[model samples]
Target: MKSRRRWRWRWEHRGFALGLALYTLLLLLLVSYMLDYGARRGRALGDWAWEGQPPPAPPPGEAAAPPAPRHEAKRNESEDSDEAGPGSRAGGKRHIYLHATWRTGSSFLGELFNQHPDVFYLYEPMWHMWQALYPGDALSLQGALRDMVRSLFRCDFSVLRLYAAPPGPRDPLAPFLPGGGGGGGVNLSTASIFGWRTNKVICSAPLCPAAPRARSDVGLVDGAACERSCPPRALRDLEAECRKYPVMVIKDVRLLELGALLPLLRDPELDLRVVQLFRDPRAVHNSRLKAKQALLRESIQVLRSRHRAAEPRGLPRRHPLLPPGAAAALAGVHPRQQHRAEFFLGGALEVICQAWLRDLLFSRRAPAWLRARYTQLRYEDLVLEPRAQLRRLLRFADLPSPPALEDFVLNMTRGAAYSSERPFLISARDAREAIHAWRERLSREQVREVEAACWEPMRLLAYPLSGQEDGDRQEGGTVPLQMFV
Candidate 1:
């Protein structure tokens, strides 16, 4: 009887041991499967995140255009190769940044610098950043944009390679490229830049044999002629050309605030100066609406930044007011979705006004040294008094207003026709007409909306509110220029 009891106990112990071993094996298998699945997910996420280069889970209301082919190369081939650190400035160069927003007459403002024989100007060089990282919140991309501009100021063209991807089919510059492929260390040329055809440095001697060197007397270089004559010279060659100029002017509408640029301003080596441009909000809104389709992607991105900043951490990813198909509109595949486009456009304008107000407040309280380095210009003032304003603008930059430059300015502002269709194109236009075009173009309600949204900034900037008499307006008095003499 004792032997039988002991055997029973041993059998029970063996059964419990077998069960424990099976359970442990099953747990191990589950863990292995989970790890493999997680790794696959991480890689998939990496494609959109660019290995965490951009932020995650893009704002819900937006969709990025299909990302351009990724360029994976060694560290030497990247913009990281730039010698200057983020705070380090370039010496022996007077760097000027035209700080403005879209449709604020900034293109024309930039062209003035581009025409100067002594200035090497880059029109929206950071545009490549916005394009390559489409739908990335403007706030998140600010660092990368700032870095690119820093490198460009130092004449480091390798920064361009970081965004060197093949142009999309809808890209206007696509047809200009003779050949195209993008990969690690792809050989980029002048054709790869956004306004390359109009770039005087690329169109002139040593880079393109057919075109004469840029001079005030030369006026605007024939962009078409330059496109036909200039083949794709290496970007390194362009950088060599960039080094020859004393003044480097970069005009970009992407950088939204004056405060964000304090680091660059403080860089002793750069000797950096800023020219901030402002326009009447109503006029800006009108211009934006007219070019709604072309501006769709940018509008969505701006709105995304505004939404992200305003929303609480646990709130819904999308704003309640944002319409469905916002993503589709961004992708350019849903042209029929006009409502989505308009909502984004209006939201973007509101955000722009708020940003401008923030800039205005910051500029008012800046240190004396910073104030000395910054200047504010009004689009209306520029157009209303071209000769005087042009002289003032040049004086601020320490550039002389040559006879040829004066003529160029006059011709541009006094031209006969303004093409609404190709609004982005840089050409001559009736300045007075362009400034007041909003009065007739925008509906009364639209004007009211802008005035309400931008009332604080408008009041401070001396813009007249809707329904107010000219005599009653703040600007009725002689408004002093916030300029550094």
Candidate 2:
């Protein structure tokens, strides 16, 4: 009986020991789980705090880097008007900028690059890619930059809709810019290939008269407002396109005003290369007459209630340098007399010549940025020897001329079918009299008027017009503007 009781007590003690061991194991597991869970939660919270949101899927086939907090990885630089500003274009040090003038053969240049297998050329991007995010003053440097970034990421459909809606006098972009108009849908094709949204010249795209019922609508824009607000986008898109080709070309014709273009394009990261194409004064006069007539027609076509006769303004005053030979002969005319003189002598022709004379200097004294980035080219050289000229240009820009770039050149040379210059096309023929075309293109009286108007700008540009006596009559009818040697 005593032995049995001792054995039973020992068994009871063993059972008690087993229960305590099981309890201890469970407590240890619970503490370990709590610690592990806390660690994971801390890590996730830390990541969220740093990164604004989950990183987007990387570009196809490229590894997406882990997103740092939006604050951590973002750069704080000079304020840009919208997204895709200099920072975006410099997407890690690759950038290109093309500065070509209107009719300086830039459209052909655009075609030349757009044909490249690796190149995706964007035309006048400054005018085409603008998406004004809100209704207010035109895009500020900061505002433009931010909105461009938003364009890259999906926009608030509502904002895009508002930007797209048009037909109002004060375009949504008016506050941000001086003129009007905006681009249509984003070019998803460009974004997919080169990671950018690019457009050509900024023009009004006809869209159905639609209003944004919800956020999904991005309609078309009015035309003029586009001019005022699109430059930043053009600059931004060109900068992006350059990343892929590292050689982008652009021609913003609206940049006719120096006040509109230079500051935005002066960014160092853009690697801008400008080409100031020129023609002889004779050729300039010819082109100006055509341009004047065309503009006059355009004004008539767009004859708004506020018709301001869209004729070219004091173009002579625009330049500080006039040629000494052609212009110096007229230095004695007065201002009021010049306007009156236009009717008696070709007043229109005098205005053009004087403006051109002043521009020669103005072109030279352009801002340091343009001066540093540009190379001058003549129109004749571009047309006659495109390949050779392009090669030299490539060399200047530190780019290798491709073996088959001649193919591109052929397209430019052979693409357009313009009629050979007719006598009337280049200039009005000397009716019956042996016309001293240059001297007679503008009357002495008209020349005198221009001399006064063009003198100030001509002086600023240090224009040394060829100080030669105007022969009352050249031996034959010759336009002295050209060096026909």
Candidate 3:
């Protein structure tokens, strides 16, 4: 009996060991499958990352026929010709970069592209980049900025989310919830404008399953699952849309140095075109000053409110120059002294003129190949002759001028009136009046100061000298073209 019991126990142990081995094999298989699936997904995402170099030029005489007369035919012909090069045909899309300075009527020019049915327009995607690496903080930021722009051109906005994340607990705003939540909770609405704008644009697109959801709730569900699912899916949708559209346009005023972006123009995959929008330097300076004055008033009000709040809390005030007692004293000072102090302390107008000069110099020095792809448009020309100028711009961009384009120009400027005060909005009424309105607003001394600071650029760009030039000459005073070089 003892021998039989030993034999039975051994058999039972063998059976248990066999089951354990089988389970281990099954777990290994499952893990392997998951890893393979992830690899596949990653590969798919990378396929849309960048279009390799452009295709070699066709042999002489092998080029496609010239565009036909009909608008649709011309569009088709352009597409066919573009396909001759690999870079241009990468998913079949054309790209435009609208480079401008602040207060240059760029907002209105951007709207022209935004209103197009066939165009996928992005407004200042680099705003996130700027916020991440605020201009003067780092000198090595250009490479990173260029990479971000390249990703965006290919419809990969996932990188922008990294910059859009909320600040740490130490952030002043972190303690208050704008939506009535308790302290230490984040307010999605106020966290990052870049994120909010990105979310709005992504959710508004047709492919987002979460399109109906509110902007705050987007990509926040199911923890990591939503984060993983939303961006790739939206990017895939954007890629498909890019294939359908003939052109993609990105506009930004922060790209003051055109030379930094020349590399992108040379990229085969980008097929990039540049529209450099400039305004009269004096006008830009005047507009910037007006904006500063308005901002100063708003800031003064906010400072008073903060002082009122801090007094009850027994907290120290933040503004060194605007102490509670000093606030009243400031009102009695001359407005000109106040303006001078603001500009001197902030280095505002000087920086503006310097930037204009820097950008104009960089544009002038661009190489021949880069210049071939570059087109310059004046804010005055655009506002004064919207239809004609826009038509020229469209042709330069290699875009067909459909009836919709004409309607957009007309409708954009028809109802609104010009106002030096409202710099942010598009005013379609009286383009010529708006063009020369700076003459009436800016003091002669201020104009001369601007001219002295930006003499080379002002002369190069043909902006007439204020009050010093012949009235009969419509263009700015002539300087030797060699001076620009």
Candidate 4:
């Protein structure tokens, strides 16, 4: 009886041990599957997120265009230099950022700068990465990376906008879905705005994220506050960042406005160089009218509002409601064509965008970039004299104006072209008159309203005020040449 009992006990013990081992192995396998699944899921989402839409299909029998001529390397030169070499980091002294505003001949200027062998011309680095939440405010390092990672998981606009940073990019991607500047540097500079010398100084914010658990109840304030709350060390870090680079040129328009950018620019330590490019207000407005965008309404409204207020040459802006003021340079500058509400609103949009632009270029922002830290160039002048303007600009930026620039100009004009489109475009009159073009659809009252809306900005950019100037000149300003550089 005792032996039989012992045998039963042993059998039971063995069965229990075997069951426990099998269960452990099952758990391990499950965990492994989960880990693999998670990694693959993350990668799949990432691939989809970054993949751009495919090019439009060509019809049957239409061959793709022939390839352009490739540059043959000279035997003496290092091949790697022709492309961005592995040793390129050794040559990267400092970045030269060209902050190109929309419709402001940014590409033309970019190609021009790219002519110099040493200058690293970065085209809209920040603009390309925004998945859906593009056109957001400025940015920092950590926040930008988080947004990029989050963009992979979904294509939600509210979700996307939640992740945008206005200035540039931010970093960190361990866990994602984030929205997230101010400079840490402060230089007290007296700036004259509207003939009043206010002690217009900008203060900086340190670089740090807002508290992770902070609820997203309040929108802009939360963002601005979080930026404000950034640690002082980050501000110091940014200042130090510019120091390591020998010279950097930045040209993102999101940070261009005087009120928004002045504080960031007032850093005493930065020896920044800025180039302000001006487009004809009419052309700018015309482009704005034709632009198909999501967040553009706000910008268009801002433009239209400004145009209705002032004329070019410090003239009083026209307002259907406000009426024209005496000695207003912008008075009576209505286009002879019926105000195509959508198109002629260019008059309004140009007037408005240019007023602010004038302020940005010649006013407070101009002086800031123009300060020992900057240089200024006009796009009209550039189109008029690309070689001379570029050479002078190179000298101003402390870069050599290479003879190759002329050839570069030719190559860029004839060869390196990306899209066949005007840099700052004005819609042809017939198109402006079309039903979809906003001609047939717009009422005369609407035209007058838009014209009134455009009146101010027209005055500011010096659009022809039919009041004094003869309307003989074709389309307001100097006849523009090839704008895309």
Instruction: Tell me the spans in candidate 3 whose CA falls farther than 4 Å from its real position.
Output: 1-89, 135-140, 167-243, 293-355, 358-368, 414-416, 420-422, 472-485
Cα lDDT listed for each candidate: 0.69, 0.37, 0.53, 0.37
Better of 1 and 4 by TM-score: 1
| Runs off by more than 4 Å, candidate 2 | 1-101, 125-243, 257-268, 281-285, 288-372, 407-485
Query: Alpha carbon lDDT of residue 44, candidate 2?
Result: 26
- Model 3 clashing residue pairs (backbone): 54-87, 55-86, 413-428, 464-476
> lDDT tens string, model 1, 444-473?
667666765676677678775654435553
Query: Please, what are the lDDT tens digits per residue for candidate 3 over residues 1-485?
Result: 89999999998989899989999999999999999988764332222212234334655664565533322331233334433332234443578999886677887888677655456677666666655553332123444666667776765555566555455122221122132111112232222222222233344444345544432231221222323334333333444444445677888765434555655776667778888887877777666666665334222322232212211011222222332432342343332444643454234434444445555555565555556677888777676568988888888777766676676676655545556344554445556555666778876556655655555556567665544356524532322222211
TM-score of every prediction relative to native: 0.72, 0.40, 0.59, 0.41
Cα TM-score of candidate 1: 0.72
lDDT digits (tens) for residues 194-214 of candidate 4:
100100001111123343222
Q: Looking at model 1, how many pairs of residues clash?
A: 0
- TM-score of candidate 3 relative to the true fold: 0.59
Give each model's clash number: 0, 48, 4, 47
